[model samples]
Target chain A: MTTQEDIRSTTADRHGFSEVGPDDTEAYVELQQSLAFTRLRSRSRRYLVSMAALFLAVFAGIVALMSWTSEPQGGSSVAGIDLTLVLAAGLLVLPCVVTVIHLVYTRRRLDPLAEIVRAQFERSRR
Target chain B: MIFSLIILLVVSRLGRARDTCSDFYVGDRTFTSRQNGLALFGTFTMMTSFVSLSDQIAWHGRRGVLLAAGFAVSWLVTLLLVAEPLRNTGRYTLGDALSLRMRARPVRMAAGTVTLVVSFLYMTIQLVAASNLLALLLGLDGAAARPLIILTIAGLTATTVYYTGMRGTTWTQIINAALLLTAVLVLAGALLVYYRFDVARLFGEAVGGATTSGRDLSGPAPTGHRSPQPLEMSSQVLTVMVGHAVLPYLFIRFLTVPGTRDVRRSVSWAIWLITPYYLLIVLIGFGAAALVRPGGLLASPDQHSPVVALLAVELGGVPMRMFVASVVFTTIVAVTAGLALVTAASFTRDIQLNLTDRRDGGERHEVSVARRAVVVICLLLAGVAILFVDANLTFLMSLDVTMAASSIFPALLFAWFWRRFNTVGALCCLYGGVAVTLALVTFSPAVSGDPLALFPGADFAYLPWRHVGLVSIPASFLLGYLGAVVSSERNDAKYAVMQVRALTGIGAAEAVTTSPALAAADGEPGAPRSRRWLPRQRRQH
Candidate 1:
């Protein structure tokens, strides 16, 4: 039986490609362990956690308010709509607003670190 | 209808595909962020957005808003977490990214089978929906008309995929998105004009109408509802969010761009487009609830609601209704074309080429196989659609989404971020997660013992919830972690290389041979390897 590795090697040889050499592997390990890569990973984890928390809090808030508060308090209304309903709808659109902000922030904050990692990879090629 | 059909044919023809796997699978990595973004928007906003969602809101106001919110937030989760790394890692399918770490045929086979299952389910739903709409439009009824419409749609979908491949599909989807957005905007504007441009008036009337019908506009659904329970609402939201991120058809769109930056741009464009689209959907849903009444155009008395079409008729007239219906028809066909293309690519690349160890030189045979696969898959989908023509297939769609969230989502999460994940863990996650989700759903209320169940006469519902993802998703993550730790196999060095490549996107967009060429630093010392292996250097070769 032909294993997948054998098949990959045969295909690689036929396509004039060499597998990753030890030198390249070493460089990859070094880059993976570097300070910039570490910082990037930490920052990514922070961003992921914060975004999840934000979404869950808003989503849970909407569900609780919608389920528990069946009738509006004091018969008050936001623009002739129930305050809870308006709040639910507004909360639903909040993530979209936050997404735009997050995208801009991600590009601003993360791009430089990504560039630093790229420069490190460049230096390793020497 | 005739005009829309002509436009679809022209759009598919404009794709002008080349006979290479790269061109067929990822559009030769040539699409700009704007083009791919529009295509992503089109691919995602399926029949649910156009027909079923508004219908839900017309009937069940609170639930509809939640579902729409789930969809909007899900795309953000995808953009922030999955899009950039997935674009940097995979070439053609989800299998490529997973196989990079596993290096096994079983892993690819499992991924391919899941992709086939998910896409097949989604495709059948779209076909059944479009045929139902077409049947209503032509005033055709009965079983014969349904099958005939299914066959017509299946034929058109296959033809589009055969001619356009990915490039044509993308072009077709871009047109579909533009047309859909315009139709929806016009409908919403018409509704607004009817309400004298008062957003508050629209909301007040919608609430009044729903309240008059004994349904609260700001509370939980009925306890005996066929949907998921109120307690499990958060899980349902999470399921949609996670499932949307890893949908096989939408997932493949990430790899159709040239680099990491384009991937980010593509998703950003999709975010801006999709956010506004969902907002309009909210307005349209409420408009349907406020304006439409019993025995209206939504009087099809079918499971799928042509609520948007009904609202159009009420707001504008017959001609506007036809225009909106045509746009929905085109949207369905475009989405089915995309699903068919993805399933074919998965079959050709993951199963036939990788699993069977096929060694065709130059991949010409692979392209041929993909084209053939499209016809076979569409035929099979048509048969399945006919079988479930009268059944309520929302359960199947829910199951499909759960399967995606439970299986692919966990596997990709672990493989990308977790360092100790190995071949065993991946296989276990793929096969085990799918099996658990299937078993749970089979025994859950979704399959039996409820009004909307596949077998309402049967009573074997061991689980109370309609969506099994609440349990299966967390179980999948745990299975992956335990599978990784239980086995002693580890590939730290390979993980290092993959991690580097995934983060920086150094050698992601090239043929396999070019990757090693970029790493060639052994012989020459005149210049740095990165400079020597730049695009200018590669072109000189």
Candidate 2:
């Protein structure tokens, strides 16, 4: 039968798990549940889900518009471009703008929480 | 041929310094975000995008724009939900990340199986397409030369992977992406100039030609060739989006970056490039419809050659055609090498290492094993490509995407985000998902009944839908949740640790810093010392 030491060593070797002593496990758990880490994770998840929903809505709208409307008549023109062409181009550019905005907003919101978590982790390690 | 030889030589020379498994597999985590971004771009824009997207657009018209949009949005999903956490896991392979909070052996085995299946299917499609393109370019006819071409491409790809590994592959991908972008931009620019940059006139010409051929430029025509149903379009797009989230090759990209921030930056850069590149693809497709004679283009044996190659020929003649062909060839070579490298890495790191319990193996031994695996996998793929040379490229690719979506994506989502997910759930997700997808696809119209089915002469299909993602994707998620809820083994403590590590780069793998000063300057000495887990090269002293 494998002893406790053997099990710990095997786990460390195979899975790259650091050997966390009994004394450190409590601290590790505390650090994991600390407000900073939780806040960071929750905020990240909220932002990701909201952005995904928004993009999905845009995609659905584009598909609906394409399907519901008839092709633009020959007389319709935006500058030299056809009305249909202009609309399609606008639809295509919309998502890129949204993605950039989401990225910038997410970074601004979450970076501080991440920094706090990092500082907490450093303290726990000490 | 000379270009391939030169690239091989350059890659081999560059790989000489890759003495450790870390270096071979993840570039020792030293690549800048810009370099990784270019590699990511190359990985996403595989040969399928080069060859198949134009044909799809030519066939489907405006509906094909949805497919391109779907491709771009898939990368957005990856950037938002997956990239940062995946990098924070500090794992070299998908199996590494998934097994972090679960029972190692079983989870690793399940992930390994899924990776093998998806990568094998995806690689086979690339190889077959490459072989077909080679035969066409060389003026070879009949079934006899096809196998030879497949073997040649496979052999070349395997050699590149064996010698250069990930580091070499990354640089090669960067170069290939540059060449591919240049080729597409030139073709698109030429076409635009030909139409004098008048979008209205271009569409007008396209509609006229399409009408003459009894088709519609804007939407589905009344002719027998109807547009894809909305559900079908949605299923295809969903499969691609979810598949992008869990593909092993893409996961390997995260490991090449030093931290989560770089991972986010790298994917953002890739999106910035890929978004515009796809827009250009739409232009080129519309240009093909507008500029080429409908009957003439349709009459060509290779449907995409006129759109991709002859358009260049029309403006710059023989020299431009040669340049475009070279670009296509480089793309196929670079992508095949990258795929082979990831497959070998997964097989070695996830399967072989786990099964043998050979953690004691030194860096040299593991590197050797990876090289040997690359050779074996390439040979197997070559044989499979020869057997399935006549398979429809789109069908094969869709099968790959379906498997990825149904098996890997659900499991990865739960593994990364769900606190309640356990090993049993993961197994169910991987095995049940693969079984369900393969069964559904085998009975779907893609395999039979339809004129474009894999075996068109056979009439065994009973399933109404051609693509299986609509049912299989949701089924995998349900089964995974059921398995998790029912299992007796619950490890909330382990999940907490994993969640913390994934959210913050607390215990993620660090870059290999040889300088003691740098290691000292970085706080948390214990975390940096864990580099002992990674086998290092012996010092020359």
TM-score of each: 0.90, 0.91
Name the lDDT value of residue B446 in candidate 1: 83
What are the per-model C-alpha RMSD values against the true structure?
6.6, 5.5
Q: Compared with the true structure, what per-residue lDDT tens digits does model 1 show for residues A1-126?
A: 222332333223222222455566667678889999889878878987897788778777877777676663236687666676676567557766777777787778776787788778777777
Q: Compose the digit string of candidate 2's lDDT tens values, residues B74-102.
A: 88778877787788764677777887767
Give the best candidate by lDDT.
1
Per-model DockQ against the true two-chain complex: 0.33, 0.34
Name the 10 consecutive residues with the lowest summed lDDT in model 2 chain B: B532-541
Worst 10 residues of 1 chain B by lDDT: B532-541
Q: Pick the candidate with the highest DockQ.
A: 2
TM-score of 2: 0.91
Q: What's the TM-score of candidate 1 when only chain A is evaluated?
A: 0.73
User: How far is B260's C-alpha from truth in model 2 (Å)?
Assistant: 0.9
Report the lDDT tens digits of candidate 1 across residue range B1-541: 6744764556544544557788678766666678889999998887877788777777777777788888877887787778888887787888878777665477778889999988998888878778878777656887699898788778877887887687667766887899899988999998888898998778777777766666555455732466446657777778888998889999889988766777777887888887778778888988887787544523565667688877877877888877876777778778888899999999987887765546645567788899999999999999999998877887888888999999999999888888889878887788888899999999988899987789989999988888778899999998888988998767676677678777777557642222344234212222111221221112110
